[model samples]
Target: MNWNDLEKHFSSARLGRYRASCGGDEAKAATAYVNNMLLSEAMMPMLNVLEIALKNGIHRQLSTLYRRADWWEAWAGNPAFAWQTKEVVSAKAKLQRREETATTDKIVAELTFGFWSSLFNGSFQSVLWKDLRLVFPRCPKHQRQRHAISSALNQVRDLRNRVFHHEQLLWLTPSLLDLHTKGTEVIGWLDPKLVPWLARYDRLPASWDAFQPV
Candidate 1:
């Protein structure tokens, strides 16, 4: 959606005209602004998950990363890390990995695997490969396995974080409204009875209450 159209869909939401730096990266200011807004759409669910996790003793884990969550983070590779993972006290291993995220492919691989593994249980390969691997179809033959997933996940994470932070959604680009609407499925997960609110946000998909993240 164009800026005006985006403003129309989201009342009171405005694109940050003046460039605002995120993590001191001036080049990413504009995209970061729009992403900041769009990502908020994910918050209702992420926060719901946070609540569920909190009620189930997960909030204790958030205060200070001690387990897998804090174990394998790549500090400089992600901008939102500034906000989300900054509290994590790095150990010798991660600091070494941090030093290698860009230098050695092996380091990037392990760090990438660790990052997603922390997000979800079980092995990290499937989730990372499925969501991030295919993003760079044209990557050089060998580089595809190593760089593509990391690069795609990083870029997507930045955009996702921008939206998560509620900065701005539609900036000055084109987005698949169909895909955007699919977010209602997520709402369904949070509240199986939120069809009305989903419709209010124009996120209710055709199947409606049939499935979450529909």
Candidate 2:
């Protein structure tokens, strides 16, 4: 496609916005850079590991708090807790569709990243975080507030959804890279092994240089 046609697909107003932040008036360069970052094999695995760590990490904490592995049925299954029940049912449906044996770990693995991320939302914020805090052993040592972690996770969730939906992130450039870093750190807090594994193949460390203005 010609430059004008390409620009139409990406939108000139959006390109202008990126130019304000990134400098230069090269819409083609900006669009190419954004497309490259989107197509790169970095963020997806990081998000995958992140979602796994979140569900597993949170499941561990919840199990301890409720003193049972099947805590979801007791804690989330009720008329008063219908939202949580819906999330659980959705997770189970995913588990069943895959034709794999259903277990707590597998069910947690099948759960959407949104499910774990939503634990910090308005519905569960007041009570959930207290139990959830114990899993992030490093957070307290660094004196990082629970609310900060909640906000960071929510940010990752937003970024994850945007990327998966093929939306614009180039305008977010510097701050977008910061969110990727936050994602890895959050994964580390949950599972130390996952950090090194994710970093081994991660391209963002090098990929980010292209996003900065010359």
Candidate 3:
């Protein structure tokens, strides 16, 4: 299809960045648009593994620290963790709305990635980080601080949001590569064994390379 067909179907607003990036070359812009989608698709496995591992690692630590499988209940009762408590309540409510029993596992699965990542922010440092840090045992002691882990989690969370929302990633090729590396590193920090296992399915590198200018 030609540029007119592409723009009409995808909308000028959506394709604007691709057109600009391609120097007004309609063909190149169309190719870049499609390549952007391919790159987004390729990043999914890495994002999936990172999110699951991070959440499970956090859940494991919190459960052990609080001495209960449903450790979020402790947070719900604490005023300092009011915000996190709201997230937990919301997740449970969502599960109940689906007619699910809202079991601990169901509630955990219902929670958003944002909920898990938000736990690393400074606001929860005193209340959660003391024990939460154990989630990243594979990380070197020097680099295993709350701020560093928070930054990495937030960055990967943002990338995951963008990818899931079908946003343009062509303009962010370099940063996207860095985010991919950071995401995988976080996964390894959670469990070193997962890195080689994940490598077998990762495709973002090849997808990025395919769309390079030269």
Candidate 4:
């Protein structure tokens, strides 16, 4: 298609508004950006599965450590732990509005990745990490400390949010492939079998290869 036709879809405002330095033919650059987004979309299903796995895995681990399903709620009384309190409050509100009865498992599942990721924040690093760190077997294998694992999860979380929000992924640092690998690795830490299970349906590798300019 010619420039005008391309602009009809990949409008300069849409394409150039965020990423101003797009090189080569503007149309081709926009096409590449669109293709990258399509690839990003394809990775979502695998990412969704990964998100659930991480959530459940961490929930189970923490529950076992605390020996209580409502363990997160205990932090509510602590004035210094406001962030953790907010997450617990949010989860409780979600459960109260559910038409179906909310089981502990369902309530835990409903919590956002941000909530789980928050457990790794420096504020809880001393208390929470002692128990939570035990769940991350793959971290030790990779020579990653708790901070490293937290950093990786936060990066993947950022990428996941960007993809879902329709934000630009092409400009992400460390490359999307690297980010996806970190996500898959985090999944493997939780459940070794889940890695191959996700691999069976993951379209990221091939889609990414296709997006590379021929």
Task: State which candidate has the highest TM-score.
Answer: 3
Which residue ranges in model 4 land beyond 4 Å of their true spot?
Answer: 1-13, 17-21, 95-100, 141-144
- lDDT against the true structure, each candidate: 0.38, 0.72, 0.86, 0.75
Quick one: ranking by lDDT, best first?
3, 4, 2, 1
* Candidate 2: regions farther than 4 A off: 1-40, 76-80, 97-101, 122-126, 141-144, 191-197, 211-214
Candidate 1, residues 1-214: lDDT per residue as tens digits? Answer: 5544544665422333323324434345544544443445533443333223212222233213433433236455665344324333333367566674433234333332224324322233453344333333334556545343344334434444555545444332323233243333333432445545445544223222222211
Worst 10 residues of 1 by lDDT: 205-214
Please count the clashing residue pairs in each candidate, in the order shown. 17, 0, 0, 0
Residue 208's C-alpha lDDT in candidate 4?
A: 76
lDDT of 4: 0.75
How would you encode candidate 3's per-residue C-alpha lDDT over 88-190 as one tens digit per residue?
Answer: 8898888878888988888877888998988988988888899999999899888899999999888888898999999988777557788888898999899
Instruction: Extract clashing residue pairs from model 4.
Output: none
Clashes of 4: 0
RMSD of each: 14.9, 3.7, 1.6, 2.8
lDDT agreement of model 3 with the native: 0.86
Which candidate has the highest lDDT of all? 3
TM-scores, one per candidate? 0.27, 0.75, 0.93, 0.85
Q: Give the TM-score of candidate 4.
A: 0.85
| Stretches of candidate 1 exceeding 4 Å from the true structure | 1-39, 42-87, 90-144, 172-214
Model 2 lDDT per residue over 107-191, tens place:
7776777777767765666767778877676664654556677787888889888778665565564466788888888887776
Which model, 1 or 2, shows the larger TM-score?
2
